[model samples]
Target: MAGSRFVGHIKMWFFFVPLLSVALMPAAPDPSLFDIPDAEAASVASSLGEVRTADAIDTTNRTFKHYFVATGLVQASMASSGETQIEDGGVANFASRWVHNFWRLVYRMVYRITVMKYWLLGMLVFGIAMFTDGTVRRKVRAAAAGYVSPLSFHLAGHGILLVFGVTFTVLIAPLPLIAPYWLAIAACLGALLWKAASTYQ
Candidate 1:
């Protein structure tokens, strides 16, 4: 149920981005791609019993509405399988593609830590401070004051993990996640860090 809700939220988020984009754009289009012959349109309308008039009125040329395009954009979620069809080969490699992607992301996370100087330095300093300085740790805990009890801490920790997981998924997403998404990620990580700083040792 939680998984369904998560996916629903992701899809809802996907649905809004394209709508927001269109609202900022110029106007409606008359694209040839969505166009069909007058005869075909009339036949379709008649078959669907949607034609209200006695005669099938013909417009200059019909095209699909922007709503179709906007909703179609929701299909581009990161969790979706990129492969439309499997390749023909002697040995068709039957493997879970998302599992491979999951490990690849994990490797990338670790690899970035090793290669990026700022990340490495920050991790080292943060780790040292959390482990060594009791006052600093307490101050950090005070920053994330709401999740004080163990139950709240655990719940917040899980929530942070879910957000981080979604962030990782967005790495390979087709949608333009943009700056706001990154800002949210930064805030989430900062909260997690504050929570982590509350250590007894």
Candidate 2:
């Protein structure tokens, strides 16, 4: 009986020792498993940087557009204001006064011409002979025996006046007066040309 009990105890020790050792041992890792890939991490970082760069570029463009729009609005407002001021004060008063004086002069000249037609005509002829291109007048006079043709005199005076007036007013006159003044000069030119043509021969 004693030998059988000792044998049973030894068998129990053998089984329990092996089970305990197995429970305490550390587990071995799988060879197929690995840490995070370096290529994948670099790609993710580069993608985040690209997003930031795109956002910065978009912000810069938006800022420039806003600045340009504001500047345009300011310039437009200033132009409108200047236009209104000119219409209300400077150009309006000057144009009104000029038109009034011009018409008054025209009326006076018309009355004088109607009252003293023959005398004024004689004086105009004398004046042209005295003041015009002396060479042309002398040639015409010598050729026609003291008869002065009015064509050269009128053409020179009217042509010079027309060119000077058009050039001066177009280049130097204000915007408001340019159209009316240019039209007046053109009409004078037309009348002068008509007179020159009639007396050409």
Candidate 3:
């Protein structure tokens, strides 16, 4: 009786093992799960195009920017949702300061060139010459009537002072962009001349 009962238990275990294995297996993914209607996709695409067009137009006007939604329905939904709460845990102050400093730096480069224009321009020219090969710099130096090597102390000293002069001149100079870009080309030539003269001196 004991041997017969042990054989019956083994038979039950064999039946349940395959059943448990099948139950634990993952289901196969169906391809049709994320299918969206064609009409809905087309509407969304049109709305995106409208938003892009408005943004492109706004960029040309530098004074102020206006945020525009493509569809009235979208705007209505956003208005109903109200403003989102951004949880920065007091990091907002740092973020604001960072943005302010960034814009200040950019403004100094663009509209407020009077302060550091020469220094910036001179550094730019010096950096270019320094990073370039000696032979190439020698050729340019010869053209400029100077013997400053690409990595020489003289080059750096002149370049350092050159920025001030260039920035001063750029601030005082009136460089208007002419039709067909002739004046712009002239201004570029003027810059090259200035660089050469600074190095030559």
Candidate 4:
């Protein structure tokens, strides 16, 4: 009877051992590409002014790390598959067999002549708007000594550029060429503006 009791206890221990081991195991560390240094974090906060508070700075830093890890995985996978090639300073590869070097050359030439110019202009406008908004928000927050929602700043900056972008497309480009994409961009801009305005108020 003692031997049998001992055997039963052994069986119970054997069954519970894995559970205890699993419970005791350390959790896996987060796969972050890099930590945001204090100086860099402070710089970002300073640049964004009052639009991004300390909490927002931390959130942005974390988000950036997550984005880096996710994009790094995707880039690695693409490289492994030969779908993308890492050249001198940039990525190069065709997504489909139909997209060859000749087509890419022609596309690039056209882009440089047309799309690239407008895109650069749009970017410049957006950057200026962002700087202005950040400056304004920072001044307001400093004066009030209260947190200001970043949403409005982002919306105002993005919305103005998006409006210009859509207008440029409609006025300069063919409707058939821009129709499919214009609505999506317009909707996104509108939604962002609405959310930002609502949040700010």
TM-score-better candidate, 1 vs 3: 1
Per-candidate clashes come to: 0, 0, 4, 0
- Which regions of candidate 3 fall more than 4 Å away from where they truly are? 1-87, 114-201
Clashing residue pairs in candidate 1, if any?
none
Model 2: per-residue Cα lDDT over 1-201, one tens digit each = 647743444444444443443332212122111212344234423533666435534554454346544557434533433423434656544444433333233232232222223233544454454344444545565677665467565565556454444433322111222223434544555445444443444
**What's model 4's TM-score?**
0.25
Better of 1 and 2 by lDDT: 1
Report the C-alpha lDDT of model 4 over 13-66, residue by residue, as the tens digit. Answer: 444443443232212122121222344335434544565445454554455446
Say which candidate scores most in TM-score.
1
Q: Please give the distance, in angstroms, between residue 3's alpha carbon in candidate 3 and its true position after superposition.
A: 88
Q: What TM-score, over all chains together, does every model reach?
A: 0.31, 0.22, 0.21, 0.25
Better candidate by lDDT, 2 or 4: 4
Model 4 CA lDDT for position 182: 35
Native-to-model Cα distance after best TM-score fit, residue 186 in candidate 1, in Å = 1.1
